[model samples]
Target chain A: MIPVLRAAVNTLVHVPDLVRYGSKPFREGSRPGSFLADLKARLRTFEDAAAYPPHQAFIGNLRPESLADIPSPWYGHPLPGASHQGPFGEILGQGPFYSMLEKADQFGLVSLDAGWTPPANGASAAAKGLMSAGARRGTEKEIRRRIGSGEALALEHEGALIGCIRRDHEEDESLAARVLLENLAAKASGAHALRLLLEKARLPAEEVDYILSCSEEAIGDRYNRGGGNLAKAIGEMAGCPNAAGTDIKAFCAAPVYALVHAAALVQAGVVRNAVVVGGGSLAKLGMKSHRHIEKRMPVLEDVLGGVAFWVGPDDGESPRLNLEMAGRHPSGRPSTPQGMMEALVCEPLARAGRKLREIDKYAVELHNPEVTLPAGAGDVPLTNYRTLAALAVIRGEIGREEIPAFIRDHGMPGFAPTQGHIPAGVPYLGHALAAMRAGTMKSAMVVAKGSLFLGRMTQQADGASIVVES
Target chain B: MDLDNQATIKQLVDAHGAENLVVVLGMSGEGVRIAAETLTTGDPSWAGPLAGVSLGLPVYHILEERVRTRLPAEIYAEKVQLMEMVLDVAQIEDALAGLRKTQAKRS
Candidate 1:
C-alpha cells in the first residue's frame, strides 16, 4: 500500500530574545553543571549573533513559515530570503511564547490586559477555558521576584504588574512551570502547524486517527521523571479532539520513525490518517554555541525548530512512502560508519530491488554547514553523500571512478539546524512531495540515525530509513 | 529479572571446581562483596558487554553447566555494587579462554 504525504508544516522559535529570561543561567538561582551555565558563559563571551553573515544566511533559508511555500533546497541552492515568517508558522519571539505558556498552563496561568494601558502588554489568559478563573493579583514582592529572577517574563500595563507566571512548584531543580512553559510553546506551535496541515490537506482535525510526538523533551517531576503521554497532550492541544496519542523516541531518528510507523498503520488499515509531530528542544538551545562563539561565528543554533506531517492513504496525486523499502539498523550490525550506511542505505535498496543511483536525493543530517563547519564538525550532508558514493563503489553498484559524479547527482546541501531530533531527515519530505508532484523527481530517500549509547543502553548506533516515490 | 547468585555459584563450582575457577554474578550486595573479595585487586570495570547487561538487555549463554540467570531490579541499590564488583569483562574473558585451553588440552 502506498503511504501518502497528505500535509507537512515546519515552525521555529527564535529564542535569543527570550534566552536571558527563559534560559536557565539567567534564572534567579541557576544551578551549576547544567547546559544553561555553559550557555551563560558562551553568551557573555559572544554578545550578539544577529550580526554574523552566516547567521543571517542561516535565517535566509528559513523564510517560508510554511514548508509548502519553502523551496526544497536539495535540488539546487536553498530557498532565499532572511524573513522568518510564513503563512503556516513563524519564528515566534519569546514574549508571545511566554504568553502561550501562560495560556497553556492551568496552575500558573498568566493574564495580560490592554485595559487603560498604553500600547498594552501583560500576561492575560490567551485561552479562557484553561484559565477560567480570573488571575489573582500578584504581590509586589512576588512580581519583583518573577521578573528580577528571570523566572517569568513580566507582564506590564503602563509599567504596572498586570500578570506573571506563578512559581507553583517548590523545587528549583524540577520546576514543572518551566517544563510546561517550554512544552506548551511546542504544543501551541504544533497545534498551529497541525491546523495549517489539516487546512492544507482539507481534512478535519477529528479525522486524524493517531498523533505521535517525536520531540525530545521529557516533562515530569522527580517522582515520575520521564513518565509521559506528551503525544496525547500535544495532540489534544492541537485540536485532534478524537485521536489517540503516543510518543516515539529513538533520539534524532524519531520523526522519520514516526512516519514509518504511520505508514505501517495506514497500510494495515488500522488508521486512515496519522500525524507525526515534533517540537524543538529548549535544552538544546545553546548546546553547540560555545564552539560557534569561540570560532567567531553566529550561534546559528538560535531557533527552536518544529515540524508536523500527515501519513495517509495514497491518492494518485501525492508522493508515496515506500514502506517496504524502509531500512532498519538491526541488532548485531557493526557500529562503524561503513557499517551504518550499509545497514541504513545499501541493504534496504537491495531488498527493494533498487539501485543507489535510482534515488534522486538523499536527505541525511541536513545540518546547516555554516553552523557545523565553524564548530569543526564539517559539512554533515556532504560527508554523508561522499560516504554513500564511496559505499556504492565498494558494493560494486558503481565504479570507484563514479564517486564524485554520484555525489553531485544524489546529494543536496543540508539546511536543518542542530535541533537534536528535528533534522533526522524529514525536512526533505516537503520538497520531495513538491518535486514529485511537479514531475521533476522520481524518488527521494530519507535516512536517519540515532546514538543509543546516550541512554546507557548500548554502544551500537541506531538508524531507520524510508523511500518516497513519485 | 532477579539474579540467582546461589545457583550460578553452585554451577561454577560443579564445572571448573572451586579452586580452579569461580563465578560471581554480583547480583546482591553480598554477592558483590564476595566477588570483590575473590578478585582481591583491580576493579569490576563495566566497560563493554557488562555495561550492556547492567543498563540494557542481558546476554546469556548456556555454560557447560546449565543455570538460569535473572537481573536485579532496574534501580536497586545492589546494582552499583554489582557493577563495581571485581569481575572485569576482560578478566572474565581470560577465564573463558583458560577453559577453552583446558578443553583443547583434554581433547
Candidate 2:
C-alpha cells in the first residue's frame, strides 16, 4: 500500500474591509479619472456579513454541498439563518478586523487606539478569540499624524473611521504603507486560519511539526523584491512555537503543490504533522469591479480569503490522500487544454488503474460564477469539468451526450472567493472530508492550474492534482 | 487594440475587397462586441487604420452556429468543441449579433 495521510482540519477566513487597503482598485484608483476610480463607490456596494451568501459559505455556516440545490444563481439566494460564526471559522467585519491588523503587527506599524472604539456587537467579541498574545500597541497620535502627512491610510468599517496601517520605510516605494498592509493582512488572515485549524481540529499548536505557506504574497523590501519567509511569520503569529517552515510558490497552484509536499513529508517520516496554509491576496480584491458595477451587482471580490489544512499520518478514520496517484503537469508536455487534462487527470488515473467515473468529485479553480461571469471570466470550475469530460469523450470513457450529466454529478458550483490560491483547489477539501466521513462519497480529486506568464519569466502553464479516498 | 492588426486587416480588405471578407472572431464576452464592431463599423477606439474606415463586413464569432456549421464536424469537434463548451456561447453570439444589427442599421 502507498503511504497515505489525512487532512485533519481546514478553515477559511473572510475579511471584507481589507479590500480598500490591499486591492488593486484602491491602489490604482487613486489616480484621477482612472476607470478604477469608480471602485471607491463600488466598495460601498459590498454586502454585510449576514446578507452575503458566499461569505456564509466560506465560514462553514452553510454547507458548500447545499449550493447546488439552492438555485442557479446562488448569490441571489441569501441564507437568512447565516451567522458570523461557523464550525470551521468566522466571517469578521471591519470593526474587529482593524483590531486584527493591530494585533497581527509584529512591528510597531499598526495602531488601533486612535479614534478606534470596539463595536458594541457580538461579532467584535467573537473576533477577540482570534487575536494573538503578541499584539503590538500603538498611539493614535502616530497614526493620525501619518494619515495627515499621507504616510498612512485610514481603516473604515460600515462608513465609520477605525484604525490605520503605516509604512515601515520613509522613501522606498516597495515599503509603501499599502504594500506593507497587504503583507500584514496576509499574515493576519493566515494566522487566523491556522488558529482556526488548531482550534477546530482540536490539535494543539505545539503538535504541529512544520508548515508550508503557499500564499501569493511577495513579502520583501526593494533589496530582495520577491524574497520571503511568510510561513515562519504566520507560524510565529499563530503560536506554533515548535513549527518551522518555508514558502512554496507556483502561483495559484501552490496550495495543491504544498498539499502534496506536506503529505510526502509526513509519508517519508521527515515530519509528523505538516500544515499547508495560504493567506488571501489583497491585490485581487475588486479585480473585476468595473464589470460588477456595470452589471449593478455588489462588489463580490471584497473578501480576502485564507485557507489552512492540517496533514497528518492517516488515523484510519480520516479520509486518506493517495500520495502515489498524485498528478503533475510536466514541462515537456504541451500546454493545450487537452494536453493539460492528460497530464493532470488522465495519466495519474491510468497509472492507478482507476476509471474517470470512480472519482466522486473534482475541485479545480472554485471561483464563484457570480464574481467571474460579469467580468467575462467564465465559470472557472465548470470549464475545468467540461474539459475533463471532453477528454473522457475522446477516450471513449463517456459519450458526448453524457457530458452534461457527468458534469452535474461529478462537479460543483464554485463557492470559494476569487482569491487566487484560496480557490485554486483546496477550498473543497472541507466538504469532501465531510462527505467521505459520512460515507456519502468515496473519493474526490483536486486539480490546480497556474498561469506562469503572470511572473513574466515563462509562458508555460503549471498544474498539479491529488486524489483523496475514504 | 493593436495598430499592426488593424493595418493587416485593412490590407486584406483592400486586396480582397470588403464584399468578399468575413471576419470570424474567436473572442469571448465583452471583447467579442468590440472586435466585431472594429471589423464592421471601423475601429471604435479611433486609434488604428480601421478608424473611420467602415468596411461594413459581416462578422461572426467562432462559437456562432454560422461559423461552426461551416467547419468539418470532426475538425470542429477536435479543435473548437471544448472551447465552445467552456465559453459563454450565448453571450458571445448575442454580442456579435447586436453589433451586426447596429452595423446593418448604419448602412
Best by DockQ: 2
Candidates 1 onward: DockQ, in order: 0.02, 0.45
lDDT score at residue A88, model 1, on the 0-100 scale? 35
lDDT of 1 by residue, A409-428 (tens): 78766667687777788876
Cand. 1 TM to true fold: 0.67
Mind giving the per-residue lDDT tens digits that candidate 2 earns over A21-65?
A: 545667555777765545555563323534566666666666665
> Which is the leading candidate under TM-score?
2
Question: Model 2 reproduces what portion of true contacts?
Answer: 0.47
- In candidate 1, which residue pairs get closer than 3 Å at backbone N, Cα or C atoms, i.e. clash? A65-A86, A111-A123, A111-A124, A112-A122, A112-A123, A112-A124, B1-B71, B2-B70
TM-score of each: 0.67, 0.88
Cα DockQ of the candidate 2 complex:
0.45
lDDT of 2 at A296: 71
